[model samples]
Target: MTTTRMPRSGSLPAVRRAALVLLAGAGVALSPLPAQAAAGGGGPSSAAVAAAPAAAAASSAAQTVVSTALAQKGKPYVWAGAGPNSYDCSGLTQRAFAAAGVKLPHSSRMQSKMGAPVSRNALRPGDLVFFYNPVSHVGIYIGNGQMVHAPRAGDVVKVSSFDRMPGFHSARRLA
Candidate 1:
């Protein structure tokens, strides 16, 4: 049987889609510098060039995570919900990245410690943004300085900005 894959436009934030379209239009490739190239002795090796696609795939996975999180917007925020419907702070992040094939703990504090530390200025789309002194809240960044997350009980999953989040602490990249 032939299957059709349709673009889920509603799930993608406009900034993400636009950036992706621009990247696709530009035909950009990121070729990392190999030891030889770093020494100024030769051009990037085939391995370095080959790895670019993997990096791109990784980025795509991150985008998928953000889209998944965005799709969960408006879902009810439960204390420990981690599912197709409702979600908690870390649960939302957990389920989002899980869709991208990355495993994450359910606790925001635990998830915060899993990925490399990302400085506020260096954050990119797909980085996990954490909040509170003890890392009590987590959100999936979706570019344009915004993130999608489960705020609290009686509230739904929503988009928030770093400047507005209470006690903004740190961020991490899982993909």
Candidate 2:
């Protein structure tokens, strides 16, 4: 089997990098990791992260998912790539959420049935927003009515407004 990797780009600051390792080693499970970023800035990692409200952690998780998704913008869309360089619609969403400690199915139709149903007017960041009948496609909601998705076989990962996604099916909040 082939594996995908992302060469560390040094895009994240040194402290955040250290935080990633330290927290990952501590088995902190990257759930809403703004706590790690906060801790990296010098406060006690455990206390700072632990004291954070549940909502803060969840919000951080959502942000983490969005950032992870956006990082792949311009990556080619592959039919079944679940990757560091290329991805399919559901593959992109699965990878992003997994980075935030959420597991997802690879099939868009399966994913649509996994998370709690959310209304169009109530969509929030990190929600799995699906499109097309039979739910052939999916994307990660990034607020302001925008989503990051792998549109198709020839397209790259990109951010698009709601109008760009036809067959606006239901949204599901997984994080």
Candidate 3:
């Protein structure tokens, strides 16, 4: 009688990288292990290695949205505005979210009413922060404790650190 063994999926290298990327973000740092070091003679399978790039691309895209919004700092503010000319507080946020492929309502009050509430400390790059007694103002939280918004009707869009803004009520993550 001849004896034969089936290769287990666990033995594949590609499966390992895919699992790692899924477990962590694209930022997962991996040290190259020699093929001989692995249980199988072959290094991690091609699939795992291929998965890394996709995860990295996703993370990079997310970062780009925040950066793009920040880059628009100093642009003029136009009431009831959106896009290349100028922006109101909500218009700035709407444009920023649109850049990241998320759509939001035109009014700050409308926007403040959407999305899950996030704590100030837990805020992420694309989150929206609301302000004022009646929630008349809104800004896009760009991570690192700062946000981008149109300060007033006469002012231009700008980036303000969290401490610089007054009366922050809550943050909402849109993307």
Report the number of the highest-lDDT candidate: 2
- Model 1 — which ten-residue stretch has the worst lDDT? 32-41
- Count clashes in each candidate, considering only residues at least 3 apart in sequence or on different chains: 0, 1, 4
For candidate 3, what is the lDDT?
A: 0.59
- Candidate 3: residue 17 Cα off by (Å): 19
Residues 1-175 of candidate 2: C-alpha lDDT, one tens digit per residue: 2122222637455544554444445433343222211111111123432343212123655777777777777788999989877889999888887775555678999888865689999877778888878789899887766777888888788777765678988798755
Model 1 RMSD vs true structure: 17.7
lDDT tens digits, residue span 75-173, model 1: 788999997677899988877776654557789998888756889988777888988888799987766556778889998887765566778899886
Instruction: Work out how many backbone clashes candidate 2 has.
Output: 1
**173, model 2: CA deviation in Å?**
0.2
TM of each candidate vs. truth? 0.67, 0.67, 0.63
The predictions' CA RMSDs to the true structure, in order, are: 17.7, 12.5, 17.8
The TM-score-based order of candidates, best leading, equals 2, 1, 3
Give the per-residue lDDT digits (tens) of candidate 3, residues 44-159: 22343233221111333234445555556666778887765667888877666555434467899888866667888877676779998789999877655666678887777766
Q: What is the lDDT of residue 143 in candidate 2?
A: 71
Clashes of 1: 0
